[model samples]
Target: MNNSPIHILLAEDEPSLAMIVKESLETRGLKISLFADGKSALQGFTKGNYDLVVLDVMMPEMNGFEVAQEIRAQDEEIPIMFLTAKSQTDDVLKGFHVGGNDYIKKPFSMEELIVRIHNLLNRKKLQQSSEQFRIGEFIFNFPQQRLIYKNNEPVKLTHREAHLLYHLWNNKNKVLDRSYILQKLWGSDDFFSGRSMDVFITKLRKKLNQDPTIEILNVRGYGYKLIIPST
Candidate 1:
């Protein structure tokens, strides 16, 4: 995983609603930059590094669709989710037409919003992940399923091992939920899958133990977190 918080750009005109959304997302461990208008949001997008963009459909100065167009021009892969009250089919189609990745109707639950945001982020990550990753002294090659260190023979990894390591690396510095990993790799989070994950986790730990600075920690009852300083 990257070594920074998930930063979000939010464009909402209503002060109360903006604050509520900001606080709610913050409590869930996200960093939000709130703007009161679409133009200001576009400006923020230009100046700030952000993981995702959430834009309210109706705003002064500009609208969500306009901002999305600008953002899409600048960064084609960044997730753009529209917060709209419009129920008309044309409006929904228009949002997608302007490069909106997803849209939620107004009066959405924090839970639903969180789920959508996670889904978008996950999809973007999978699509754009690099073929290789650096983990402390080791370089991980996802496509080749190999782990190489200094000039020595690379450590060959099984398909499952490579897949797991790639995801762990994708979410390095953040706690990766066990259920999420299980579902991605095993297709279900059943008891058997959980046990299988434990075995793989043990195998990975041993393989990576040569680097003292790198750790795949079991976050107690939650999940695993790969702790490695940026190289």
Candidate 2:
């Protein structure tokens, strides 16, 4: 939320699928480091501070389950998700056994993939020792869906509102493309999604009105921007 994007390490041998996934996540302001095989991906994970790791089951050098085992040994906290075509019971159990927090069968929609990633992240984030973000004078606890401002009653946020605010906070002081946001959050950038996004934005604006320095701007033909003046 402090202008640092969520860093993710992805191990995928399928070039087309990997490219599509990487670009999709990146469009949502995530930082993705892609590796073609398990060994390289494992190496990349060791060299990086990744918030999450996405592994493909079959690959040259090393397979995902094996890679996951190596990663689990080194860092037990980070979220690990498996991507594979195998829907067999044994493969599914093996993935979980190897420290995978979530699994998505191949031929999956981008929306499903994103949702699973968020679920894993939200679960893992709360499981960790700490997780907090600031918007003006307010403390936004995302996983709890609570927005606290001083001694006032906390404003409980809906699921969509929380996600919208999370994206806004991450890209604060910069324009967040409406289309990109719609696709990232609502899975489409159509008229209905745009209108829905607008309503959520309005609600966020009202809740954040306590701080005059904070503003969620409409960038005309482009998108929205959450402005926070430097203190």
Q: TM-score winner among the candidates? A: 1
On residues 1-231, what C-alpha lDDT tens digit does candidate 1 reach at each position? Answer: 566889999999999989999999999899999999999999999999999999999999999999999998887667788898986766765676576766778898888788888977875666456578789899988766689886778997654577788889889999999999877665447665566678778889998888899999999888999999875
- Alpha-carbon runs more than 4 Å astray in model 1: 130-231
Candidate 2, 94-138: lDDT as tens digits: 675566666777799999998878876775555343356888888
- Provide TM-scores for the models: 0.57, 0.56
Error of 1 at 199 (Å): 44
lDDT of model number 2 = 0.83
At residue 5, candidate 2 shows an lDDT of 92
Off by over 4 Å in 2: 129-231
In candidate 2, position 15 carries an lDDT of: 96
Against the true structure, candidate 1 reaches a TM-score of 0.57
Model 1: pairs clashing at backbone N, Cα or C within 3 Å: 1-169, 1-171, 1-172
